[model samples]
Each structure stands twice: as structure tokens, then as C-alpha cells.
Target chain A: MNKKYYRWLILILALLVLTFGAGIISLLSGEMDIPWHTLPDILVQKEGIQYSIVTQIRWPRIVLAFSVGGALSLTGAILQGIYRNPLVEPYTLGISGGAALGIALVVVLGLHLSMGSYMLPLAGFIGSIVTIFLVYTLSFRRGGININRMLLIGVMISFVASSMMMFLMAITSSENLHGIVFWMMGSLDEPNALLIDIMLYASLAGLFISYLFARPLNALRLGEEKARHLGIHSTITLRILFVVASLLTGICVAVTGIIGFVGLIIPHIVRLVIGSDYRILLISSFLGGSFFLIVSDIIARTVIAPNELPIGVITGLAGGLIFIVVLTRANVQSKIS
Target chain B: MAVYLNIQQLVCGYNLGFQLKGIDLKIEKGAFAGIIGPNGSGKSTLFKAISGDLNIQSGLIEMNNKKLSSFSLREKALKMAVVSQFNEVLDVTVEDYVLMGRMPYRRNFQFFETKEDLIIARKYMRLTNVYQYKDHLMTELSGGEQQLAAIARALTQEPELLLLDEPTAHLDISHQVQILNLIQHLNEEMGLTVLIIIHDLNMAGEYCNHLVMMNDGNIHQHGNPHEVLTYQNIETVYNTVVIVRENPVSGKPVVFPVSEKTFKKTTNTSS
Candidate 1:
């Protein structure tokens, strides 16, 4: 038992170190090539072009990436525990589509121009909230929420939301269409410090709240009936966890447009490495996601150097390839053992 | 002995038309009782109502002189632990799985199992003979082993009443005997109240001190093995001709189904 605990500690420490390294690399290797050795001096000086660029441009994006990635992945792990299906993620419930549609509608109507830039994220947040409310209410029966019905409803709503988004795209002007598509692809270029701070703090708070229910989440792995037999109020647990996961996903989508695959892939990778014990799965997935997104962001900016690609493009390509490789190796290793 | 579990005119069912209509029963403290009946006989529904899985439409279920509905889920879990028929074999280790039984005892905001919880879990794991497979994932264990693991987890709950629904349905004969023996030991030595839903009449007769014969959502008979396992009751309830005879060694009743051919041959020869 002690050995197992120690092993988890080592794995978590390794992830922390890796995340720190990814953060440093992200800070140093943006469009302006700041040298690694000069980082400490630049921190002390605080007045050069490099200092301003690091603090203003790259640092906020890095913070945004960590929180968004961590929140999405954490929500994925929680939702999977709730639904008991591995294929579930924040986006599986049409949260991203809803947020994207909201942003598209706002851009086409030129709401951001009139109301200010905050209108974009506000619309996105409202849109996701509305979608989750619809899904939650529609799947609710006489007294309890049916998980299978919720998943089916979520999928159908996703289809509906995407079709609606496409219709909006069809009627909008080309300039507005460009804005909509760019936002849909996702980016971590939010310049608002307050929003970044909120995301960071909210993600951390989500992580802490999730830890309180780690044991319940583990109980749920035995199925809801057995979980209830073990003394968990499965219905209440499901409801609270559903709302928490959707809200986190809503906030993430509202803030970052839609960064796909981190939520889906990070948890799978972390579970493969560490066991399915939610106490560790939740934290590890959060850190692993932050590490993955930071690295993906680094690649997104540097691969094209002057012309930056959207972070979602890099995340999908890199995250998918890495997941495939990890899965293949895990399959082969299981066969060998 | 005091009545440990009392049900008065219980009426409950799923929305699919199956219902347990106005059922009343009582189980004495520390009694090894079995509920036996055919499929769709509301055996599972009755069990569900008692376990708080199904909403009781009307009537009262009291445990230890307190209404069952008054107890919170955690309090109910502290009083009774259920070993269900089917459980998803997850990727969790047996030790971890067994430790889940300690959930009811967990304090608010408790993240990990306490030392006391671990000791209790290990005790039950040893009792059920699953300690050797503690580190193995539940998916890796055989069906019988998994069932034993499930029992170990239930024992870890330290419940006063242990409820099992068809625990041995999927096990081999030897495994079935092994599990029943363990349950009997828990009942006899620890004075745990056991109410099991069993399909095997012979096993029920062998192990249970009292039997409740259920037919069409109501109790057909409730008494000692000798009185409840009679061939007439079996034939009437199960819709089959069965021969009930005494076991030479244990002196308990044993049932033998009389097939159509044997019945016909016996009728013709007698004529």
C-alpha cells in the first residue's frame, strides 16, 4: 500500500516538473525569441521590449491555456465518471457548438463592435448555459435524471446547434464569416487580464471541489445502483457533478472559443499511466492537460513563426497522434503481459 | 428474538406493470432468512423496496423499530449492505473495491480511507478469502472470485443486516457452496442478520434457518425449512411437480423436479 502511494507521488511530481518545463518553454519561445538564460534578468529588469512582450502577450496566453486545458480535462474526467462512458467530454454535450453559435451570431450581428469585445465571451457563456439547461431539463424525467437519455439528447442537440451555426455562417458577410471561423477553430489570445484571472481561479476552485467528491466518483465506477448501495445519494451526486462539469465547460468554451481533444485525450492518457483512482486521475489529468496545451501552443506559434496557426489546429493534430501512439503501445503492452 | 426487519402492506413496482401488491413480512434478528420464488415473481422488487432502490408507493418498512424511510441513505447503508446480482467489473483493484464499503463511515470532505477503514476492509477480504487477490483488478478475477470480492466489500460495510440478491446465480456449484458457507459463518459467528434472495431451493433449505416462499408478489408460506420447502408449496408456486424428501445426512428438505415423462410413466404404471 505504501509502495502504491509512493508510486503515485512520483508520477504526480514528474507531471508537475514537466508542466513547469512546458511553461518556461512557452514563455521563452514565442514570436519574439527571448533567450532562456536572460529570463531571470528580464524578470528583474521589467522594462525592456522582451519584458513587456513576455508579461503582456505570452504570459496571459500561457495562463489562459493552462486554465482552459485544465478545466476542460477535469470536466471530462468528472463527466465520464458520472455517465460511466469514456467517450464523453465537455464538447460531447454540444457545449462547444452552442458557444460557437453564440459567438457566430454576435459577430454576424456586429454586437462586439457596438457593445465592446466582452460581448463575444458573454454571448458564448450565455449560449452554453442555455444549451446545458435545455439538455438537463429535457433529459429529466418525473423525479430523476436519466444518464442515457441525457447523452442521447446531448448528441442530438449538438447536431442541431452545429446546423444552426452553419446556417448563420451561410447568411453572414465574408468578413464576419472569417471572424466566426477563426473563433470556432479556437485560440488562447485573450488580452483581458480579468478574464484570465477568473478562468485560472475558477479552474483551481473546480479542482478543489472535485477532490471532495473523489471517493463518490470512485464509488460510481461500480455503477449507480451499487454506488447508492455504498451510501452515496447517486441522484444528488449526479446532478451536482453534471452541473459542475457543464459550468466548467461553459466557462472554458466562453473564454477560449473551443479547444478540442484536450478534455478527451488527457484523461485517457493519465488513466493509462496512473490507475483509474479518481483521487489521482483528477489532478493528474488537470496537470497533464496544462502541459499538453502549453506545448501545443508553443508549436502553434513557432511552427509558422511569423504567421501563427490557431492553437486548436495544433492541439487536434498533436493530441490525436499522441493519443493513437499511446493507445497502440498500451494495447501491445497489455497483450505482452 | 426481536423483529429486525418488518414490512407492512408494502406496495411498490416499476412503471412497466410489475408490482409487489400489499406484501407483509418480518425477519427476526440474526435470522438467516431466504426469499425464494420464480422469475418475475416480485422477488427483486421486494428486495429493491427494502434496499431503498425503488420508491415505496405505500406501506411501511421498518428496521430496528424505526421507519426505513426515516433513515438517510448513509444511515441505511450503515445498517444494511446489499450484494447485488450484477456489478460492472471496473478497472479498480480488489482492495480498492472492497474499501469502497467504508464510504458510509467516511466523514464529510474525507478524501482517503482511514486506517480503521483499511483494517476493516482487510479483515473482510481475509474473511472472504480474497486477500490473495487484493491487488488484482476486478476485471481480472473470475466470476466466482468477483462474487466473493463483492461479499467481502459488503462485509466491509459492517452492516447489521446483509442483503444479497441472487449472489450465487452465476457461480459454479462449488463456488455457490463456498459463498453460502461464508455467509452462514458471518451469520452464526457474528450474529449478522442475513436476508438473501435465492433461486436454489436446496441451498436455501440447507443454509437458511427461516424461509419465505413467494408466489405472484405475495408470501405463499413463511416458516422453517421443513414447513416452507414442502413439495405441495413448490408445485403450487413454481407451477411444477416436485418431490420433496429428507436429506439423509443433514435431515433438511431436498427437492427433485418430476419431469413430464416420469410423471406420465408413474401414472400409467400405477393405473
Candidate 2:
């Protein structure tokens, strides 16, 4: 193989190894001290307290982290591609505010108490889809989605949603208020097997669909007019990607409240390493994001042992640092170009 | 033979701010035409209308005797390719960028480009003389080289009607000539119909057989360069004094602006 292919191969292999190593570390280093020597037997035989801790508790968290991180990054990649703007991310279009409002309604109305654990996520998912659909419909002008208008509308809707959520919070009992605030701050505390499985499958489906549109997404990065000239149906492509991004973002936010920067920064990091070909960019981003969140979650767990920090805090701090570095480097590169 | 492109009473604009009003023009098969005018003369707007990028308010654009709007965007793309000013610095490889031109031919949902697509991309890259930089990132090339790569990408579309908007605006003298000459050679040898918008009248005169001088969203004059590039025609439309003379080498019209000092000196010499 030529140099480029060889380098890509090496990079993929290295990422796979790192992801595997990180998964093992995550599985072993949780609160319950499962002996490292018996870890293989625990995984295979699936018995005893250690196995239960590893399988029922740690495994779901780890898998959920991977799925959520992968979904967010893939969402970011697609949004950036469709917008032709690198700064865009999953929540940039107001999905977070919408999902938060959904949960707020559920909590304030005491619906979750009656309907059980699935109610919050279901409501959040519905709210997100509705909000996205509304924003999309509002932005449609002359048979095309005006991106600038769409962004503005999304921001406006976000403000409205947040204010409504605050209203709901104000009228709620102190007990429900505390619960609402914690969920809004974002968490991965509860690991539901069914929800994680759904999100995992949804993220994989989103990734597959994104891969199928890779060529057109590549064309889209050149700009809409050019992509249209190339016969890529720029409008249809943008709409499809918008739906996919919204679904992925909705599902992620529904399960784990707004983990901010996995979507924003992971794609940028992947692009920096792998270059801008969407075919490779999407796959690498999924892997890179999975690895990043696994490591970040590990840090979140072990930093103040027995009492874990929210994963968002870690990702936000690291994402902020990375953003500054990326901004500066982009400035320097722009000047050079 | 049928007219390859026909635009009649075309009026288009972006929400009442700026408009191309009642512009009419036509291009015959295997002919090179240049659209020239002062800034804001609706030249680019006319190109947009023809390319179906702008929605026509009230007008008719026909390609191959069919309404331009009748064809799908892909059909339009397969018929005509445009090379406009690409100001953004795209982070794509030269070869991959060129491969975008073959997008019209590929089926929807087809991700991988075929061998034939690669061959066509390489063919155009070689034609535009940017084949050596096929693997190089677009950012790594100079502005002139990038412009050539853009042209190569346009050529890869295999268009019958090639439209260019100020393609040589940012190139050096040598690069400008090199680009114009390449475009000229393509029109002549490949029998491609060319409609180029150029601010430089001299280059337009040299490369384009016909000229369409636009003024205030309308065609001011349209004919051979010798007829449209006259001093009276340019002075009236552009509101500037210029000396129009023939190039001794090619016997084509060359326009030179008559600045105050140069006009005085030239008058003194002539008297």
C-alpha cells in the first residue's frame, strides 16, 4: 500500500487497541474491586457478585457511554458536514433545551412517579423530535432550508424552552425541583439495559446511514451551491442529515442529559488526525469518541472515589481546553494560508 | 443548429435588494462568449439564472430547446458546468476535489467512485496540468494553482456549456494568460460552448469570439468583440474614457483606460 493507506491502517489499529485497553481498564477499575485475574472467568461464566457488578452495573454504564459518545460525535460530524461549519454540534440546534423541557414537564407534572423510569426519556425524545421538526419547518423557505434562519430560530426556540423549563421548575415542590436540577446538570448515573440497547442500535443505524451518504457529505463540505452543481441534491441531503442528527441527539439527550462536548470536540479531534474524508472521518470519530468518553468517565469515577462527578463536567473542562488550542491553531493556520 | 442556451427577458434577484431585470442573451453551439461589464452590472446574476441557482421571477431559460427549469438539477449539471470564484479554503485533496465533478454521473446513494470516475478525474487533472499535485491538499497549492485545479474540476464534469465567473481575477499575468489560453484551447479543440464573465476586457477579447456587455441588468451590446468593445459603446455603458485598439499580434481588440495624464499626453502626441 501507499503511504497514506499505510498510515491510515496504522492509525485505525492503534485506535482499536487503545479503545480495547480503555474498555478493559473501565471494566476492572470500578467501585467493586473485581480481581483482575478472575476478570476473564467472570466475563465468561457470568456468575457471583463480582460478575454481577461487572455485568449488571459496570457493563451497562460502559456500553451506554460508548453508545452515547459515538452517537454525539457522529451527530456532530453530520451537522458540521451539512452546515459546512466546524463549530456546529448536536445541541447547537436546540435539542438539549427541548429535551430538558420534556423532562421538566414530566417531573413537574409527577408523570414519572406514576408512569415509571421510561417516561422521562420517552417524553424527552418526543419533545426533541417535535422541536427539531418545528425548527426545520420554520426554516423552510422557497423549498430550501435557510441555514442562518434555522440557526436563529433554533436559538430562539431554545430560549423559549429554557424559560418554560424555569417556569416549571419554579412551580414545582422542592423535592421535585432538586431532582429536576440534578438531571439538567447532566448525568450517566442510571444504566438502563433496554434504553442503552436502543441508543446503541440507533447510533449504529445513524452511523450506517451517514456512511451511505458519505460521498454527498463530502461534496457538501465544498458548500451547498457547489454540491448542488455536482447533483448531490443539497437540500434533500441537508434535510436527511438534519433528521438523523436530531434523532441521534434526541436519543442521547433523552438517556443522558446533555453531555455537552462529546459531539462538539470529538469530531474536530478526529478530523485533525484523520483528515476530512467523510468515509474515514465518520468511523474514526465514532471510535475516537467512544475511547474519549470511556477515559473521561474513568477519570470522573476515580477522581473522588465512591462519589463520582458528572461526566459532563470532565468533558466540558477538557473540551474547553481543547477548543482553545484548536482555535489558536486554526488562527495560525489561517494566517499561514 | 439549435441554440445551445437561450435566455429571454430574464428577471431574478434576492428579495428586492438587487436584481437582474429583463436580460436577454443566447449562445450557439461550439461558440465562446464572454459577459463583461462594470461592477454590479448583473453579469454574475445572469450566470446564476442560467445555472438555475437563482429562481427566475419572470423569464425563460432554455437549453437544447427545452426550458432550463424543466430539467432536473443533475440534468442541468450534466449539460453545463460552472467555475465560480471559490473564496473558501477547502481542506480537500486535489484529486478528491476533482472527483466531485463526476458526481452528476454517479447514482444516488452510491458511495464509492468507480474506475471510470477516477480515469475522468485524472484526465481533467492532467489536462489542466495539475496532475502532479493530485495527492496534494488544496490548501498546499497557491491561489493560481488552486484556480487551475478548480478549472480541472469543472472540466471533469464533461460539460457541453462551460460557464466561468472571473476565473483569472486573482492570477498573475502569466497565470492569467495560461488559464485563458487553456480555456480557449478547450473551447476550440473540444467544441465546448463557453460563456465566461470577465472584468478584463482585453483578456475577454483575446479568448472569447463574442462579447455580451451588460449594463444595469440588461444587455447593452452583444456581437463580435470588435463591435462591442468600441470606444463609444464602452464610454456610454461604463461612463469612462478608454482607447480601443487592435493587438498587433492577434488582430483582436485591446482596451486601455484613458487616465487624465495619459489622455492629455496622447492628445498632445496625436495633434
Candidate 3:
């Protein structure tokens, strides 16, 4: 194999291993003290006394970490492809704001819905669809989408959404306000297997659709004009990717309430490690994102020990640092060239 | 020959605060047409209008007997490939960049490039003589090499009509000559209808099948190189006097600068 190919293979394997190790550590953690020996027994569904500790709390949370991390990173990767800008992430489109608003409205208003979790996520998904549709419609004309304009609209909407959340928080009771604010900050404190399963399934669908256009993303890196000459329908490709990725971001936001940076930082890191080929970038992004989130969640769980830091906080700080490093590296690369 | 492109009273320009005007012109198929005018003469603007990059303000643009507005964007793209002014791209490999020419050909859910796509990219790269640079980074290539690569990228489109807007702008003299020569070869050898907006009048005079000397958004004089490139026409269009002579080698009209006073010495220098 070529040297580049070998390096990419080694990096992917290492990341995969690292992520697996982190998941195991997460599965074994907390005060419940599930015996490590019976962990495998619990996994296979042959009962054990510690099954509740292993399955009820630890497993669900761990699964949540993986799905959220994977979904965010994959969304980030696909968004970068669609926008054709490495600096732009999933939230860069402003769909996350729509998701945030959906969650906040349900929580702050104290809607006595029977299935709040499902309703919140569904609201988020619909919000994303509407936001992306608005952005597309506003920016598109004469068969072209102006990316800078679209991104500007997204940023403005996010700011507006953030203020709306703050307003709701200011007016609500302190008890409910705390939960809403924390949810907006992003967390995995409340995990149910059904939510994980639903998100995992949704993520799988988004990723499969994204995978269907790996080569087109590669082509898109050259910009839409050239892509059109190559016989790609630029508008159709952009629309499909935006809608699908928004859906993924929506589900994630609805489930976790604005977990920042997973979709922002992971794809660029993966691209720098591997080459910019869309096939490899997309796959590695999913794995790398899953691994990063898993590790971040681990840090979130263990660092304070008795008190956990929000997963969003950990990811945001870490992702911000990584983004700076990437910026510098890109600067140096351009300088050298 | 087929009526490949016909622009009747075609007004092409941007809507900059006020209005953009249209001008009349008709272009036949298989012609090595050149649009030449001084800077700000709307030469590139006209090209943009015909290529569907800019919508017409008023006049009509037709291709193959159909109105330009009538053709779908993809259909227009399939028929015309434009090698626009230099593009700013970073870290893209030449092969991958060239393969972008195949994007319009993909089904919605296609996640991979087929072997046939690679073959087509290679063929165009080879034709433009930039095949060796296929794996080189776009930022790494020299100006002339990049320009050739850009042409190769357009060639990958395999369009019936090739439109280039100041394609040789950044190249050095030898490379500029090389690029122009390549375009000339593509025109004559393949019988492709070539429309280029070149600044160098000498190059335009040398290669064009039909020269459109546009001044103030209108063709001042357009016909054979011999008929259009006269001392009077040059004087009227550019407000400068020049010596017009036959290029001894190609027998084409060649314009030389009159640095010293030539009005009194015109008769003496004619021989």
C-alpha cells in the first residue's frame, strides 16, 4: 500500500481502538459498581444482580455519547462538504438555533404533553427543515446559492434564537429555569434506551444518505460551477445535502439540546489526519466524531467525579482549541504553498 | 455548418445601479470568433451573457435555434463550457479538480466516481498537455501551467462551444503564445466553435476566424483580419495611428507601433 494509504489506515485503527477503550471505561463507571466479570453476561441478556447498573444507567448513557458524537461529527463532515468551506460546521447553517428554539419552547412553556422527549425532537426536526428551507429559499436565485449570504442569515437567526432562550429563562421559575438552561447547555444526564435507539436509527439514515454522495462532495470541493460542467446538478446536490444534514442536526439537537462543537471541530481534524478525499473523510469523520465525543463524555463524567461538567462545555472548549490549531496549520500550509 | 449560437440584439452586462444595455450580433457555428475591445469595453460582459452566467437585461440569446432562456441550465452547460478568469482554489489535486467536469452527469444518489469519469478527465488532461500535472496540487503549478490546467478542466467538459475570458492574462509571453497556440489547434483540428476574449490584438488578428472589434458595446468593424485591422479603423477606435503590414510568414495583417512622427513619413514608409 502507498504511504499515505498506510498512514490513514493506522490513524483510523488507532482512533477506533481509542474510542472502543473509552466506551468500555464509560460502561464500567459510576457509584453502582457493576462487577466487571458479569459485564459480558449483562450485555448478552443473561441476568445478573448488577444488570440494572450496567444496563439501566451506564449502557444507555454510553450509547447516547456514541450516537450524539457520531451524529454531530457526521453532520459536520457533510455540512463542510455541502458548503465547500472547511471552517463552516453544522451549526454554521443556523439550523441548530431552530432546534434550540423548539426544545426551549416546549420546556419553558411547561407543555403537559404525554411524550415530551419525542415531541421536543420532532419539533427540533421540523424547525431544522423550516430553517434550512428558509435559508435556501432566501439565498437561492437563478439556479445558484450564495454561501456567504446563507451563512450570514444562519448566524443572525442563531443570535435571535439565543436571545429568545434567555428571555424564557429570565421569566420562568428558578427550578424549571435551571433544567431548561442546562438542557440548552447540552447534557446526557437523562438517558433512555428508546431515545438512543431512535437517534441512532436517524443518524444511520442521515449517514447512509450522505454516503450516497461521497464522490459528489469530492467534486463539490471544486465549487458548484465546475461541478455543473461535470454534469452534476448543483442545486439538487446542495438542496439534498442541506436538508438531510439539517435533519441529522435537528434530531441531535432535539435529543440533547445543542451539544456544541462535535459537528464543528471533528471533520477538520479528520481531514487533516487523512487526505481530503470525500469517501475517506466521511467515514473517518463518523469514527473520529464518535471517538472524540466518547472521550469528551468520559472526561465530563470523571473530571469532577461527584459533579459532572456538561458534555457540551467539555466539547466546546476542546473543539475550540482544536479549531485554533487547525487554523494555524492551514495558515502555515497556505504560506508554504 | 449548424447554427450553433445566434445572439440577436443581445444586451449583456451587470445591473449596476442603473441599467445594462444590449447590442446586436450573430455568430455562426465552427467559427474561431474573437471578441476584442479596450479595457471596460464590455467584451467579457458579452461573453457572460451568451454563456448564461448573466441573465439578459433586454435582448435575446439563442443557441442552436432555441432561445437561451428556454434551455435548462444543465442543457446550456452541456453545450457550452467556459474557462473563466483565474479561480482561487487551495490544496486541490489537478486530477480531482479536472474530474469536477463530470459533476453535471451524475444521478442524484451517486456516491462514487466511475472508471469512465476518470478516463474522460485523463483524456482532456492529455489533450491539453497537462496530464503530467494531474497529481500536482493546484497551488503548486506555475501560472502558465495553471492556465493550461484550467483549459484542460474546460476540455473535460467536452462542450461543443468553448468560451474563454482572458485565459492567458497571467501567463508570461512564451506561455501566452503556447496557450493561444493550443486554442488555435483546438479550433482548427477539432472544428470546435471557439469564442475567446483576448486583449492582445496581434494574437486576435492572427488566430480568429471572424474578428469582432467591439467598441462601446458594438462591433466597430468585424470581418476578415485584413478588412477590420486598418490604420483608419485603428485610429477611429483607439485614437492612435499605427503601421499596418502583412506578416511575411503567415501573410496576416500585423499592426506595428508608430513611435516617431509618421504622418509626414507615411508615404515614405509604406514601401
User: Per-residue lDDT tens digits of candidate 3, residues A1-337?
Assistant: 3444576678778878988888887787765545667678787884665677667777778777888888889988887777766677788777877776766677766662566556766776766777777777777766667877777887787787778767877888897777667767888865556778988888878778888777667767767766654445666888888878877887788778778888878887777666577777877888788888888887887788778898988998988997787768754466222
Model 1 lDDT per residue over B126-240, tens place: 9999999999888789999999999999999999999999999978999999999999999999999999999999999999999998888888899999999998899899999
| Alpha-carbon TM-score of each model against the true structure | 0.98, 0.93, 0.85
DockQ for all candidate structures vs. native: 0.70, 0.57, 0.33
Q: Which stretches of model 2 miss by more than 4 angstroms?
A: A1-10, A170-173, A322-337, B15-21, B260-271
Report each candidate's C-alpha RMSD, comma-separated, in the order given. Answer: 1.7, 2.7, 4.2
Q: CAPRI verdict on model 1?
A: medium
Candidate 1 chain A, which ten residues in sequence have the lowest lDDT sum?
Answer: A328-337
Candidate 1 has which clashing residue pairs, if any? none
State how far residue A99 of model 2 sits from its true place (Å). Answer: 1.3
Q: Which candidate leads the pack in DockQ?
A: 1
lDDT of 2 by residue, B151-265 (tens): 9888999999999989999789999999998998999999999999998999989889989999988899999999999999999999999989999999999998989888889
DockQ of candidate 1?
0.70
Winner of 2 and 3 under DockQ: 2
lDDT of 3: 0.77
Worst 10 residues of 3 chain B by lDDT: B13-22
lDDT of 2 at B55: 89
In the range A1-337, model 2's lDDT, one tens digit per residue, is 3455676778778888988888888889867666688898988997888888888878888888888888898899888888777778999888999999999999988999999889989988988987898888888766867777888898899889999999999998999999888887677766667898898899899989888789888888778888888777888888888888898999999998888899889888778766888878898888888888888888888889898998999999987897678757854354222
| TM-score, structure 1 vs. true | 0.98
What is the lDDT for A186 in model 1? 88
